[model samples]
Target: MSLGAEETHHGSLKPHDSLFRDAEKVSHSTHRGSQVSWMQTLSLAFQSIGIIYGDIGTSPLYVYSSTFPDGIKNNDDLLGVLSLILYTLVLIPMFKYVFIVLYANDNGDGGTFALYSLISRYAKIRMIPDQSAEDAAVSNYHIEAPNSQLARAQWVKQKLESSNVAKIMLFTLTILGTSMVIGDGSLTPAISVLSAVSGIREKAPSLTQSQVVLISVAVLFVLFSVQRFGTDKVGYTFAPVISVWFMMIAGIGMYNLVIHDIGVLRAFNPMYIVQYFARKGKDGWVSLGGIVLCVTGTEGMFADLGHFNIRAVQISFNGILFPSVALCYIGQAAYLTKFPENVADTFYKSIPAPLFWPTFIIAILAAIIASQAMLSGAFAILSKAQSLGCMPRVRVIHTSHKYEGQVYIPEVNLVMGLASIIVTVAFKTTNDIGNAYGICVVTTFSITTHLMTVVMLLIWKKHVIFIMMFYVVFGSVEVIYLSSILSKFTQGGYLPLAFALVVMSLMVTWHYVQVKRYWYELDHIVHIDEMTALLENNDVRRIPGVGLLYTELVQGIPPIFPRLINKIPLVHSIFMFMSIKHLPISRVVPEERFLFGRVGRKEHRMFRCVARYGYSDTLEDPKEFAAFLVDRLKMFIQEDSEVTAQNEPAERDNSSKEVPEAQARLTQTTVEEEKQLIDREVQRGMVYLMGEANVTAKAKSSVLKKIVVNYVYTFLRKNLTEGHKALAIPKDQLLKVGITYEI
Candidate 1:
């Protein structure tokens, strides 16, 4: 069964409420109620930024340290640390993410597929606007346009066509993301919870380490347990807490930045990044890979595209997001210079001793909150994918109608919970998981970069200089991140990749299996010409042989092409084949089902016809459509009024009673009656259940066919609806199938 879009019907409304509403066109808030000032939007954006952008937002802790270990070994590399921090926060986040991907966000949704759909749709329209516009442009310009509108139009059309390849790539990324994020999903709560619990150990020196893990486990159990209570409510509370957390990091960052002047200001320079790669050689690029740790959560932007408004995300990133990240990282670089001999993580360790434990607990809580973005993101992507026919339907509960993206899956949550705890147990430290984290996200980001490059070249009329420079910078950054994680695979990073492989393989297999089954069914179509020929002037109980329908036909020869001629002719003779050749771009309509016949012209013995639906009619289902055609044909042959006009004139000589009898017979044509008889015959095969109709398999091949049919029936039963199964005797009688009645 196909998973179509939900109708989302509304039933009733409360007092002073309308159930029917348009969220995009109709404003929810009254103009008199509030203006939603920029500062207020910024404040809301800050809160949302904390919730949506926490992963990348928290990167200052580890990324700079990971990058500038060489600087730490020496006392004076604060410049290098500052440089890396500046480029990462002020450049990467500011220029690359905030200015680019966010701007490319599709129709307020940000992700590869959403952007793909948006750019493709709009690009095509803009490419070939109209003749009046083309002429007006020519008059306005002294020179001809550089590119033909039609050429650009074809280029985009081809790109959109190539998008199936892009979809597969995106689906690959989705699975990769779900696996890694799920892995992170499991570890986040455990590490965050245990670290928080561990903070108490400093306050209470006698507490055992086992007690910490146990309490951590208990907190995780509870945290995992309550996800069914939608995150929308929790996020409202969590977002503000997270924002304060960012502010804390910001305060500490500025604290370190104000006093230290080891070229701390120069960290804002982009040349530091250029020099880091240039002077340090390949090791510099390799080490700089850890810089991805800062933007690791960038992919979360794509994953969580469905959750927040694109405008809100933009406001958050350029305004609250980048500035806070810049401050924290600068603080971290400054902290290292003063305490090179012994450094704790700059995020927590930068704070004074008096506030250490409290801040540590706060940091851990922030990480748990960070986990929420990915957890919620995975649920949203999977749910939307299922609705779009790219995934299987899992049981999903939409927890917040106000926020359609906030969904809960008991199965998904439970699995994430298990995977997260296992990760905490496996790695035993935040550093270990940190290395594990960036690999999945950066790979996905890299793939998106590649996808967007294709989109730009084929869809957007972007300048070559811009595109070349864009790829060089972005691709190099992604390659650095990927290489950095290669060191971690031997430790624990490969687990997510290995897990992702399993999921990607499963998705590919299911899609192929469905395609095979559908094509086989489509190939067996019986043409109307063949059916008409099968029924010529015969009064017979059975055809006494299986019907053979040929699919392929050669040109001309009255379309009694070789395949049709060979298979549908003179054997048992009551056979048909419908050849439907569809153009990849055209729609197939019912009125196009017509015959091109040779053999059937003389005696209506065998026939061939075509159903003119094109390849683009991708939404049509084989079995359901076949059933629909049967119903329409039944009405047309048995009771349609048109046959009365021609036949009633000749039969007027008969008496009124005789004329009525002939009319009844003509209304129910032999071809329509024969189809019903064949359907009944197939249904009668079910009698093998009760030991009736026990005729032995005749041909050597029929034995395998019978067994295959039996297996198919069993599998089909599992996939069908209860109502559909009820119409079949197998489930109704509950006697034919091997399964027992469980009353």
Candidate 2:
């Protein structure tokens, strides 16, 4: 086992060399401190109002009309519905999300993946099995494991990590939440834009329903077309228009409260909520579906947490969005009580005649802004999904280098735009669009509540009594809304569910097949000992330069290499097996990005480099990656030398004073020689070898599985961004080794 039989070796340092006793220390720290003036903080809060609160702020346009579609029965009905709206606005968005859920962010990143990251760190319920200790060291994965000394904490962690069922359940729950958000992405644009433009019919009564649809479609086309410029440009433009819209609504509401029925303010009492529910019974229960719209974009409070700090989002919501929306809803109720027949188009009709056209113009702009936020949200969710391995890899373009979350996916943008047009044309009314919107919104809310409860029990380790109390309060309210939305399934409610099912099916199939394919490669991977013998065969020609063989196997040599050797009968002078893994954490520190080690033995001239990344990390360019690998390979060589020296015996006497000097000279000489060798080897350039795997099910597999694997998953795989392109690998130096397998 010489590294190269013809090449002479530098004298090897024996064990007990004082200079090579310890390995290099690699320390990781996740803390970062910065100072910001209040002026800067205030600027961010203003921007956050424009970006984070758009969807929720625009809810006033349709909530009242959606609730009383058939028109208000009497003043008491208006009062009751207004009371429900007032309390819901207070309970969910203003209280729970602003004060509580925003605090549960993963290193300032939020959404389903953030919660999953938090929970996975404390327990062993990570669905992906290839996770490493280095992966857990990512900044966002900074949560410490539960203390084993506590019996109850240990029991919960064991239960969550030990059971296969728990892993699947947690993964499924996250997928459902994400899928519903995607559904909202599609529904929100259609409903928001259509409702906005529909205001035109009040002024121009001659305009047909088809005309309104065409106008909405045109608006959406413009919105989606400009998405490539990214939200950083559009977000600032939207905030001022939305701020003015909120002020207009608030001012109009106050005017109507004085001029029409100031007594409608009595709806602020909780007793009306109870009396209304008791009087109307099932009718009032059913209207909960519409009332839920008041908190339509509440999830954005949690979903968009990555874009801003908790304090900024809360300030935007509490200081601006909450009061304006509440006043607008109450003003609509006041106007409706004075003229009960206007309930069908309460938002538009309730406006004072003098300011109707101006308000209508602002409403359209606000709706467009709301749709923009949802579209951006959908892209973010898809990007995170791809990183988590739940979805196929898509082309993700970062619109702003300064903000990691400001991304745009061209494919998703096109799909959402098309879905919006189809829904707007088919539904022809906000009444139907609202039906679909309520279902998606309530379903997502329920899913978040469930995930939060699990967080409280497992990660937060709250007392069972407090956990149950949370469930009884928020969970019970969400369930009621869910029931109400379920009743409208035949109307437009089926739309979001259908969208969710399609997206969920795609994600589930891709993940299942990917896990299976990975396991198959693992079970059949080639061990280094077998490959070493193949390398020594006289029939095989050893070529110059480095071969960077890329594979998914984190530990062993890929089977593709021996297969490649069998065909070509040639090997490179240096072989480095590389694997890039995306962890479920939000971000990985640059210092801990690469993990280097020997393949088997040093004389083999083979090494392994694992380039680990978190979901939020941007991959380095190809040239940078090559340089990084070479640098880390040098470190690995040094660490290996240190470990070997500590294991072997020393040549000099232990008591000799000159022994330290002698060891230092030997260590420096050996390191210099090794560095020269590495420099020479690398001068010949590097080639990247990657496998193009074709996967299919076995003949004995079930028809459903075969269809899923060979058809659905294959389709997705073919359409996604290719590995080399995504990695920014140079085309000239790239080599593809194709392999086919039946799972």
Candidate 3:
């Protein structure tokens, strides 16, 4: 009774007017040929500049001013900062991310979880055990076969799987990375907007600091207010603005190079980096905290890969972003060499006097677009986390059905908006926000290096020397940046660390409770034979309608079944034990998404269906899923008859026809009776059954266990959206059975 190839059309049969109607026609381009049309390539690259590169592109707004807050002291200091900025940009974002990290993309999706998905396929490190063998056929579940290096890879896999400490360390590192990404959603808007609006001071030197903060806060208010409208609209509106911004800044840079001191170009040599560091000494080391801002939004390159293709993103970066940003930085340095007094206002002062007003207007627009990218990335991370069961369920609105990744979580949007406003008002300057921003940026980069090394060993199967070389090179670079940022802990650098700790706690607690709940059901699992024997007694009355019982267990009968029968006297005539599971992949194909089987013989009228989805798959309402299941059940009966007919022998056709005629009569009678029962039951309606558990620590447990389980986990469970609401179950047809559990 499997819903494999035969039930492929069920998704299209959904109502055309449904909110997620476009999800039926999922735009799966993975299987298409490598060669895309020129128009598609161009459009994708253009949109990539708007969505993928906004944060990095806007880095020029604040990097220079932050590096020399008290103003550029000498030519040595200026050239040194420029050299560090140039090499940092070249090493981290350009060489590391562009050439190497992008290759580690998971089935075209990229992020911490995407890397985790790739690593989990070859190791036993995953916490959730819901995935079944049939899940391997999902379109995105890809892993290369073990080859000549199989022995070495297997050894590493065995060591990692058997060790509890290693498993916990890996999980902690991955969650901390994801939490920092969410923290970026709060900090990017604050710094980018404030830096752009700071240009107002150049024109009106009389404007007080409070006036600047007020204007920046007002712009942030408008930015977050329109977030509910979603990024599809925002992307289209900002693409042209960003395109113009790049061209405008590059033009200003070329003019500045020809007009101001051209000797600033000497900073391109690595010698200046050595000379600058040697000259500035300790001050040069401390300033790496600010210089790292040159590559602030580099993570967006990997995080936003789900929205656009790799080739398109690469083209956008190489062809447009790289040259434009380089020219802008060089042009600012040239202006500084001529008028050292203008270091505090490098961007606007460097601009040709006639074009300052136009560039200022464009800078504000570009900054707003940059904030949108971070906000969208945060939503994507949380949505994926929820699917993996690490985060509690929240309302996920798919703003654009054409792209499954374009989502909006209203609760997240409100909180992020409020946080950004608080940061803008409280910090009141990009210098301090830059400190907090540098901490998050460097920490995320370091985590990426660690995860990427794991991918190299498990998935890529690189040689030992190659892995060692990678770790030595990238690991040292990230460590230095991290040390520099941590040195400023007292000056607004503690904010991102505080945010990450809070988010990590919530994720850890929710995951702990979910894993505990699954173990409890496994320990108390029952068998369907118990229910069959009770029916044979003929002591219990059978009700009419169908019953859909949800459970966490994939095999055997869930403990709740017996608990329900004990509490209630009767059961529905036809029953389905259903379980929904998420696999470690990006998207699951429809034909292989449902696994159906009978709980017993045909006479039992009981069945089991497991609905499977990938981490990035769109979830359907429970009512829709139920309708599809029933249609598949009807198809199963017909398919069974076809199989029986085909197996009949040709030599005994005459005799076989007679037997089949009688058998068919009996089968027809049984099917007709079942259909009549189903029709009559439909008039009475169906009901959904679920259990609501109250979890607390065992009596013998220590105080720490009580606080974690009975306090923290319990509070999250109650505060978060309930399972029924998340599944979109109809209230009139829902029944919640309550129970208590001690862990």
Candidate 4:
């Protein structure tokens, strides 16, 4: 547990120091202020309707049409399909996500990576060893539990951490889940918009299929073009449109029930679902691929939890969205019972003659909003993966100053927009797009089910029986839906899998190289004692200005630093080893962001600073960071002086005791002198020194490893954003030391 004299001096203070206690009080109050008021929660809930429910809300437009691709068999078939839709909406989105999975979030952030982060914090299953002791002290990194309650969780954690296979399997599941979500991001917009645009033919019978496809493509272009405005503006603008769309669907559904057969309400009974499958055995199973579309955006509810709180998402879904969607489905079934032939266009046909055009316009608008949910979720998952070092560094723009989680990645948006347009042009029909979209949704859901089971046993500390029940019920439903969709792999269903495999491969390759590079650095780290000896050599000369060597190592001098000194024999008068660490939480408070310590001793003029950030925190400009580091360095000097004075031995004789005024004056002068020295070095200039590592496979490695390292990883490194660029470091003041690694 000991980190030597360097860490002992800088990382802690004397028990009697009032300054340390006061800082702790401020950090606690800042965290307490983060809780939202009930009124604010309601406001957020209203906005969440536009951002979170868009995909699932628009499902009624094509559910019946997609479900009965070959046309409705009979009146009983209509009731059976409706029953299946009703229970799917209840079990998946309602009981499973809103009640269970949402609670597993890592400090309010959601999705597959967030769940993985939460589990990793409670155990040591993380594949990389980048975490330091200082990281565990973050305000939100909670891993506390009574021994009696944590027995099972501890056992599970030990098993996972002890076995390399288990660790890789867990990480693979997390990455695969993320890939599927990104696939959903592309597929949702295609299916949702195409289904809505298909309604145009109902009013204008002269329109050809190609014309409809072109119109859909144009709408998609406009949708992605406005994404730079950020989620707050988009949510505010789209909320009213979506709110009206939900009300219109619910009203039209009730109208259909009153005018058509109300007896279709009997589909609410679970018996109808059983009977539907019993009458048409193989055909009923295949219909599930279509019926699952009712809950297409269910994963979005959890994935988008980062933009809003759990309460807001829960309220929006259960209070408004859940009832409206259920009613819309039942109304469509009622109309189909009377006019079985109209099942091909149930949503548009069920509308009354006078309200048809207005309803049609709102459905189109609502469909665009639905695509936003998954697109936003896609950005969130990618951001999390990049922070955890599982993805290549890309440009991440923090779109909202007020909301930390609202982000926009231009590269991802551009690629996603193009991919979606291509799919719309190629498939060109709702049924074909539906085949691709269903698989992505169910595969993501199944991955979440498995991850959540581990979370229940470990983080949540639930009983084994509860875990089994959760897995069996949810797992069984997802497996059945997955099988039905996999059967259609030859017919458009392969699209998501193809997309997921490419994405998953990139993630795995990037993560593998990063881990190897980290081990290379760790193995060659220079100890404090060795660094001190190097400084004492006559060939080395200490220069006047400050040097901040950027590294990933927190505990010792990076190997590149020693190499720099040996090659050029020049060192800074004041040197700082700087490292930036991204924790699994959502945000780290400014007061707790930096941990500073002396490298060897006060006379060595060397220091170490570990800057910790939450995944959601933005990196400040390099100049601003330099100024902040100077201020913290000054503060550390004063605190260290105070601690030294307290630890000094008392005078044995009364006559030998120092005067109170003289002692106080002496202490103040010493602290001021040290502060001024640091300020003078700052005025001279500060330079950022970083290492440029070239990674390749070992000479005797396998052919596959060589391809991954020499080709795939090198290409990614050259094309993606570098570490310094991502941190906004100025080129003129930056210095790069080259290091080659054959891993």
Candidate 5:
């Protein structure tokens, strides 16, 4: 496929040149080292897919057995189930995922961050677009910052950039995705293990039930132990493993249909659904209790978007997975109808006892793989979230390809591990746990459809009518699924539902707290046009000297403009500047570095400046980024220091000069020396806000003690990780409110 002039090919060398920075000593940055082979790349992708698809694959263990009303509905109803399966695997995964989601990847990175990066490039990023930057650039005519395609794109993409609005939206989506997934992750293993163990009982009619329990425990333990290996290996085998699974099911289903002959054809008819519902009425609505179980893994498919190319997943579905599932359901229906008295355990009894144990083992293997898929995807997503600051960073090891995001989290493993074990012990088997699985899966699937709806409308700009048509179809299917799953509420289903609710709540709360803290930090650095004027009019303290602050986000303007204006407008007097460079997540690759752009402007002397980063930086220190600005800033205009040997600045107002000659200087100093210097006054800005305390803000606030708090809070929020939240929890218990005022 051809790419646009502005769009680089997916395999283009030095892809991040237009972006901010290359990876900087990041744990798993792929751009840092030796080039990998195509085979290696394929391996990585496959592993990622495996880790992510585990839950979806194992759904067959219950979906076919559970989708219809008890005692066989016939051919017609079976066809509908088959149709749904076909469309789900073939159409949805193909169109929405393979064609769209995978193509939407930003620099090979997927998830909200990939979308955020792409959109951030084009969205308008300033708090407001029209402001003071034009004159300032005009004044510092020699300070060459261009309005390049990259610069314009950054603002254009600001709709979901690194801002409060974007973070919140992403957080909401992640919570929805993770909650349902965690719900399934906890239950899939138990069901798979239990199902496998129970099959052994059929072979040895008198086999002690204790053996089943022992087998389950042993298998679960082994599954848990192998998690660190990642999903790649299992992912390769998934297509094949699941291929056997479907074949076995289809063979059984087809055999049953043949035995039942003409009567079996009735099962393929839709009338069975209508007639069954007509007679059962409320009872059929109640039978819907099981119909939803058929689609338990849909949401997990969405959550695993980053793990596999949409095409691969869709191919797996349409080419093979869906047909087998349909056959299995139809077969189950035929067998039950042919011999009504033998409805119970029909899926197993129809087959030989020898085959039952093997099927059980295969099913269990499929389950462990499903669980691994979820586990790894979670690790990857959380890793990206940490770097993006949606969540605090945790210690993560890369167990797969060095994508920086293909991570291993011991803590996450432990938590999920312990919880899954507890749940398995509580529920005991697949039949018991199946109820909870569908509820979480369907609920999350419904939410993904909603998110996909938004993506189509805003991002893709699809027509409203077209979007709605798809929405209605998908939504109806989900509603049907959801209604049936609701029956699970009375069963073990409440566990996953409650688990989802709790996980979502915590994710939302953390996002809220992150936003609040961001606002407080903004209060420290910003100066509003109106508020600063009012302060100046009222004889408020004069902010001294031009102060510049370095910020983490690479954008047109800081997101917390309101808090910035509210807290610091009158606190300083000099031309204040806030600067951020677009930093990429990969290592420096040379051709992509060295940027020049100006995005936003406020009244007085405050200006927004951005610089893009090059790729070779994985080995280089990023602080040198600020140093680069200082070097380039020297060309802004003849330095006032050069113009007036003694007191040039007193009369040389910035209005006369084209650009404020930011005096940021970088000196090569040892860590202890740099720390000591910052200990006195940490460097406040990237270009010239060198040193700790903002000399301007400090002079403005003579109270002294107040400045200390601001500095401390800034220091901690930037440096602290999520693990620190546990420390703050105790303080919150002692105090009714959250940790708003950092000591």
Candidate 6:
């Protein structure tokens, strides 16, 4: 059976009073959207142009120049390349992405991790065993299919879950895809800004390459520096700039078509693409490395979908962005047909004399917008990775209260900005940067295609024949593009590959150590019986006030609690084992935030509380969290008393005996009495008890494991944000206990 089906059956069999069931009543709702008003959709569509289409929109500035770096041999070559560009834009971005891939979003979040999250919900394919039945219920994970399709999905799930190699392969592909996008985060700014700035030399021939590079770097600095203002502000500001840019390009394209070769429109025929490849032979095939640049920002379209709705992205791309970009390419092709020798500067040369200056300025602005899209996408994917435990904790600032998906990561911005500047300075020309940029773009595309193929079978439950067709049609095209780019690896293409390697390594290492640490804690968890025995000991005194013990475990006492008791021989009069879990959805509702259950006997005064949050949910401060916890605890106690009172008469009749005074007192406890007791504990104040695990490799481990765990994981954990700080726990009320683990 599929993972969701299995979980549903298991959950149905659970007792009504099961803790997981209690949490289910308050679980976060599904991320499905209601129908949007047309006006709001249009506004979002307008904003999407600046954030979603910027990278691909700016492609016309460099595609022709990059494609024919050796200069066009004839009009056939121009028409042929134009045909290739047209088909790629239509097939990949329009059909494959806009229509197909966007629908695969995990609760409105996109990108590779989002895809993985969706699949993991349907299958037990995640390597980490942190997911629970409660998580599935809250995440709104489900599927409805005919028996035939359901069997196919179940088969896919069983095969994936059974094979460790398959799971690793899937995760590795996701990490690789994410790494490439982050790599693109730096490369996009470098190429887009440099290409835009290089246009200055067309009118001002005296400007040196160094001067252009300096100017581009300066623009990049300003663009990234302003990211802290968030996507809402940036989108509003950039929408007008990009909208004007599209209009200008479309207007100029029409003017060029009228004045030059209107026949260039015939390049839309697929026959030209075949003919171009046949005539140019190997050279034409290799030119794909340049031709693929037309869809550079296509991944950004899906990646940034979280910033807006899928409908808005579709409206923006199809209604305004696609037609303008296509016309711009056609116009450039027409210009190149007349002046084949001007292939090196087709974008600028094609511009009419009067509109040249204005187009140049807009190109620079649009280029910055393109970079902004990729940078924002990078921040988004990294945030998802961290929440899933694949990446180290980084400070994630949710910029828009209305749009939780819109975020800014200060560390990521600074790193990408510096990387962009370094690359612009080093490459010194758009030609070299284009080589590197094309690899990052196509590699990401190929990864997405592969992941989507799996989604079609396991999640979409498509018939095998249709699934094969989707893969063959899209995968074949991406493979051709991938080959062309890999051929140019030595020609600066290695830049992104090297960067991806570093990033992927960091992510893989971090995930590995985190899983180990979790397993260690799970193996050592303190059972309720053990906890009850420990509390009954005379030496272990229950001190006054409440203590919130933080742990990764969702059930039972944390291993650290027993260790703390052993070391100090003291416990709080009222203690809570608090586990914070990040679900794989976008946001958890505040009403369903905390799941409370008694840990043991009534007089033990101990409880287990799980604070569940979605990936995009913001954590509350310590004081607010304490208030919510106390309020929830009081309700839980009063409900427990009511249940006990109802059962007491049944027990009296069955046994023909009087209840003990202690038992009667517990059953008779009123809501007001419970409230007063909780308030009294609250007035005494709460302490946040957290554990700091120091991990090291066992002596028997291999050299590689030792190096990875001891050095890499240690360095990352030490540098990244601590759990307490990320959760906004107050330092004064926090007590951290250190525990050493050999893994």
Among all candidates shown, the one with the greatest lDDT: 4
- Measured over all alpha carbons after superposition, the RMSD of each candidate to the real structure, in angstroms, is 13.8, 4.6, 5.3, 3.0, 12.5, 4.0
- Candidate 2, 337-418: lDDT as tens digits: 7788877778888888899989999988888888888888878877888766778767788888766787888878887888
TM-score of each: 0.62, 0.92, 0.91, 0.94, 0.62, 0.93
Predicted structure with the largest TM-score when compared to the true one? 4
Off by over 4 Å in 5: 1-54, 64-171, 205-214, 231-239, 259-271, 300-308, 339-346, 402-405, 526-743
What do the candidate models score in CA lDDT, each in turn? 0.51, 0.78, 0.79, 0.82, 0.48, 0.81
lDDT of 6 by residue, 1-743 (tens): 01111111111211224344444566444333336678888888887887778889999988988898888878888889999999999999999999999988766777888788777777777766767665555534453443357777888899999999988988999999988888899999899988898899988999998999999889988888888988675456788999999999998888888889999988988999889988999999889999999999898878777667778888898999889999999988888888999888788888999999999989988888888778878887787777778887777888877666668988788878888899999989888889999988888888888889888888788889988988899989889998998888888889999999999899999999988988887787666668778898999998888988898876656678888998888888788888787776666666556666666766677777778886656778677888887887776676656555665655444454455555667556555665787688878878899888899999999999999999999998898888787778888999989898899
lDDT, candidate 4, 593-701, per-residue tens: 7776677778878877778787767887677888877887777777667666776775546775566557868999988987888888888888889888899999999
| lDDT per residue as tens, model 3, 20-101 | 2222344443622136777787788897888877788889888888888877889767777777788888899888888888
As for candidate 3, its clashing pairs are: none
Rank by lDDT, descending?
Answer: 4, 6, 3, 2, 1, 5
Would you give me the overall lDDT of model 1? 0.51
Off by over 4 Å in 4: 1-23, 26-37, 143-148, 645-655, 659-668
lDDT of 3: 0.79
Show model 3 residue runs off by greater than 4 Å: 1-35, 145-148, 534-539, 636-684
* Ranked candidates (TM-score, high to low): 4, 6, 2, 3, 1, 5
RMSD (Cα, Å) of model 5: 12.5
